[model samples]
Target: MENSPSVKSVAYPYGLMLAIYSILVLVLIYLMNIDQENWVIGTVNSLVTIVLYILALRTFKKKNGGFMKLKEALKVGLAIAAISGIISAVYAYIHYSFVYPEFLDMMYEKSYLDITERNMPQAQTDQALELSKMTLSPLFFATTTLILNLFFGFLISLIVGLIMKRENPAYQ
Candidate 1:
């Protein structure tokens, strides 16, 4: 029954899920372009990040394979997150770097001023800019994006694995 549904089919849904996530991220960015404050980009992205892991686990289950081992499930979930996150990060980097370079400057200036205005230490403002730069950098942003994805993915996979896993019970 090699042709029958198996964990092998996980590839299809996993790919589709990631594709959808990517598209959604793009739409979120577009919305941000319209109104920066209205941008819940990080939140939406983080939530979808979790969705990707859960979808991967669900697909794995649908494949009729042996119950997912915790380790294997974790690996699969993290992998999906890493790939999806990197893609989204890259897209954002390009959009900001080329399409909207001013956005970065705006964010930087706003934070710098806000911190100073609030009587916060200069170091805090500098620190915020430093962190933001790392995230805004095309290269570093992509790398951190992958790391963030893997980090969250691992946690999600662990939790989803606990819920989704099913071992065949003996009842004969």
Candidate 2:
């Protein structure tokens, strides 16, 4: 525990990585004309996120004599993702609600079309569309984005921390 760096020590790298990732997302949204409907773009962005997490953990290990406890690694990883999630949630709400208010409607229309293509009854299609709309609502989108971020971050941290964990022989 004494060997591990303080959480604040890694703050700069964690925050800078998240900020860059967020900006990259915004850039992709504008340049590639991407929206949440296309899961591929988001998946690509997540690759960068994974790299950032690994780097953060590696940096922490380097600073703390090339060792970090699992608990502390989880703290760093989750904290980075959670705070990043909050930042992203705010951005998502503002972008969808203000910058491109039509985005959500576009998603609904696309989803409706996709669902109707299944050849379901009109009543069933309507019900499905309504449910889709609820799921894609601004509030739900932001909230789920935050939760998913934390959830995935937790998983990544556990795996990475396990791989990176090393005990101080002297302390042991």
Candidate 3:
């Protein structure tokens, strides 16, 4: 146990790798002029996160002598997710604030169009747009993104941990 690497040590590197991969996807979307709201992009990102979680957990388990408690797996997975989320949030803030200041406006226009397409009454449309505007801020974006990542990360890690957990024989 003392010879095994700590969870943080294993998680940090994988977390950074995930963050970089996520950022690269974002950059690709931006450069390709693709809609940022694309569902496919989100799906791909989610898949990548799952894969990274598996890799990180597996690496930790192997290093720990092929033994990993559910709690230990959870801890490593959550740590990786937290690290990636924090970095991604910061990047998003920067991207929206300076790299592409018009992103908020673009999202607002898209929301307005969507609301209008619903054929809602003028009053209802206005109310919806108002709510959308409130949520379009950079800080809000970062906060929600970080929260969602942690939420999904927790869910995925719970399942993966349940499947992959192995008790140390000596402890038994």
Candidate 4:
């Protein structure tokens, strides 16, 4: 009988693909001069993530003779998420710190405008901008990116795993 593929073996390649795809999208957005806070970009990224998770789970199921446990699916999904998150975090750090130092300033300016447009009092606006500055730092960005990826990844994995789980007859 052929050996079943390991989670790492299946996940690493998919994770790398996801990271590359995400970076490419970011580059495309930047090249096209789209706002960093665009909802369309977020929607696209979310859809891509869901599709990749489904594809990865399908690949694993196919390799394992069309059977996959919930645990196996969860493991594969989380592994892919972690690997991709780490790579993306590193890239975010470098991109924010060096490749586009002005990006933070732009975000800050946008935030200020948004707050003022809401007719926020001066004190509240000052406080909000202060909070925004901290949140927009490179370290904060990298950490938040990793955390949000893991969070959304887990949610996607849980739902997908529940839907796709098929126990091996021999093990039942």
Candidate 5:
């Protein structure tokens, strides 16, 4: 246990990676709302995120060890993802609950109006509103957020492990 690296050593990589992802998400949200036809922004953002995550993974490996075992890498990556998810989700909750309590209402009203204007089915609008309300629940939001981020982490770990694993040659 004494020889095992403490969790503190992993914090920096986890936090820095999340910060980068968050910035990308904010930009994506802004672009998406600004121009529906400019979905290229999202594609570019996702590619850059993958590249950044890979870079961060390489950096973490270099700093932590030349090679990281699969389980260890997965653990560190998931830990980071979980922390970031919780932080981001909490911020979202606060933002919606206090900073902009009317956002949900506004969204519901706009969606309902849009549905009517388009002569779309009323059930679609009602379903969207219900889903929005469910998202307002802290527990559900946090769990889903964590699961989503952890899924990304798992993918990053799979790639990083392929690049970073260095099991000793058994014959040696």
Candidate 6:
């Protein structure tokens, strides 16, 4: 195969999906004002992201003479995911900090209510609310998102790579 696939080739599809998912999430939070119960958005994003990853891997395989080793697939998949995750983290930081400052307050209030409902001591409730506020900051949120994204992305890559790996019969 003369035209071997580069990491960039895989990153392209991942980046495209990340962009679409980012826009959809921002629109959901901004224009649609659908800021809460993000499970809906998360679910959609996770499923689509996986599909995009699979497509990218298959494309890479095709370009590599229609075979991919397990190790090669794992590296490519993880790189694609890391790039996608960094892009997402940066966008999320900007979106939440500048685009929707009100989102922080809204989340804080919601958390406060949930905490209060527990009927814990007022001091504990205050502490919980304080902790939430501290953690909800843009920097912290971005850091957490980055960590979670990488964790899940690596996990997904393991499964996807195992399924996608194909040995070249001629190699043996």
Off by over 4 Å in 1: 1-16, 31-49, 120-136, 168-172
Candidate 1 lDDT by residue in tens digits, 40-94: 7667766876676777787676654555656557667766765566666777667
Candidate numbers sorted by lDDT from highest down: 4, 3, 2, 6, 1, 5
TM-score of each: 0.69, 0.84, 0.89, 0.88, 0.65, 0.84
lDDT (C-alpha) at residue 133 in model 4? 87
lDDT of 6 by residue, 65-98 (tens): 8888877777777777677677777877887899
lDDT of each: 0.65, 0.79, 0.86, 0.87, 0.61, 0.77
How many clashing pairs per prediction, in order? 2, 0, 0, 0, 0, 0
Tens digits of per-residue lDDT, candidate 4, 32-86, equal 8788779988888889899999999999999999998888898998899899899
Cα misplacement distance, residue 109 of candidate 3 (Å): 1.2
Give a tens-digit lDDT track for model 2, residues 1-172: 3656777668556855685687567757866776654788778777878888888888888888877889878988888878788877777777767777677888888898899899999899889988998987778877877887789888988999999988677677
RMSD of every candidate to native, in Å, equals 4.6, 2.5, 2.0, 2.5, 4.6, 2.6
* lDDT, model 2: 0.79
lDDT of 1: 0.65
Which candidate gets the maximum TM-score versus the true structure?
A: 3
Name every residue pair that clashes in candidate 2. none
Question: Where is model 3 poorest over a 10-residue stretch in terms of lDDT?
Answer: 1-10
Off by over 4 Å in 5: 1-4, 20-41, 110-132, 136-143, 169-172
Model 2 Cα shift for residue 114 (angstroms): 2.7
Q: Model 3: per-residue lDDT, tens digit, 31-135? A: 898987799988888788899899998999899889888888889888888998999999888877887778799889989899989999899988999999989
